[model samples]
Target: MIELTLIGIGTGNPDHLTLQAVAAMRAADLILIPHKGADKDDLAGLRRAICDRYLGASTRVALFDMPQRDPGDPDYHHRVNRWHDRIAAIWQDRIAAELPLLSGKVALLVWGDPSLYDSTLRIAGRLELPLTTRVIPGITAIQALCAAHAIPLNRIGAPVQITTGRQLRDHGWPEAADTIVVMLDGESSFQTLRPEGVQIWWGAYLGMAEELLDHGPLPDAAPRIVATRAAARAAHGWIMDIYLLRRDRDQQAGRA
Candidate 1:
């Protein structure tokens, strides 16, 4: 049986590895790390660092190129579907080549909690092997953002909506929530929203020693965040950011 474990290593933090994740890494017959090419070599390097720090000395480690997303396709969802299929094929090929007799256990180092905005599960689903999968939860950017800003995700008797940057731009504020946490945002979607009295706590490179954070009223802070995010992304060649926005009807009644 090909047992696959999705180990959540958290966002750029080696310390985010849980005890269970460590054990899983130690038990794996093979560990796969996706290479994102030169511009994003840091991602591949981080995966290597994790493997170097963990993974029993005898365990085998494999590296595979991550397939690129096809932007020429008009249908966004269709493009993503095709991309996932390509990645699954790559994974299959690498596994067959590297571990011909592999059977016991295998794992992939996920950047964040597998259940949160990550496609590893969807890709793994395409494999026909009678494989059982396990997800080891780790801290997500949302959690790190909240902690960095000293804010509570949910306010007293209120709900928090988690969404993508695209939806925030197209649909505006979701009526379902007074608090919102946005992820997988390539653009500054918060600026599109009506910034009246909304509070924003933004974070990038969370958990890393170089983590950066900023927070203030959306109206007062959104522009700064937009410019800062742009500069940071340009400087680093890539960036991952997450933010929490809270709206309070009462002027004096905002609390983390």
Candidate 2:
């Protein structure tokens, strides 16, 4: 009976951790951090930094190599499922080795809230062991993004859609959503949209020391964001970014 606790650490910022998240981390018997190779070593380092700050001297910490997703696979869902399966197997092995008796608390520090576009919960569901899962929620990238820009996520009485960059590129803006938040986009998918009457707020490394932000009408800001993102990714070797797009209903109506 392994009590697995997935604690959201939030956007690589130590201060973003909630009191509940700190309590859960301090209570864990073992904490597993995933190493995503050299390019993203800073990500693993951030987790280590958090553990160092929050955990007691007796708490155990382990690092596991993250399984890379197959980029060649045409079906995104199949590729991700296979990757998740591999990760689950790794988690099982690590837990068993780290805790031979396997009857204590195990923790994984997730980036952003586990409930929002994150797959930690989904991967945990695939574990073959007897497990009871607990989630400690933390700040989300959306929250951090909105905070950095000092803007609300949605207009009064209006809804906002959250989707991936792939969806935006493949399907264009959702017909029902006037505002959309795009995540997991390596490509500048906003380039695919018709820029007229649309505004965009883009940020990379949000809540981190290297944070960058740019916003304006889509047509004007797109070029600057592309340049900035390219330079930052080149300098850092890895980057996590998100953007918000909102269509001005009045401008659209005026055009119509």
Name the top TM-score candidate. 2
State the lDDT of candidate 2 residue by residue for 73-142, as single tens digits. Answer: 9998999999999999999999999989979999999999999999999999999898999999989999
Q: List the candidates' TM-scores in order.
A: 0.95, 0.97
The C-alpha lDDT values of all candidates are: 0.86, 0.94
Model 1 lDDT per residue over 26-123, tens place = 99988999888888888888888888998668789888988789879999899999999999888877777776765668889998899999999999
Candidate 1 yields a Cα-based lDDT of 0.86
Worst 10 residues of 1 by lDDT: 247-256
Best by lDDT: 2
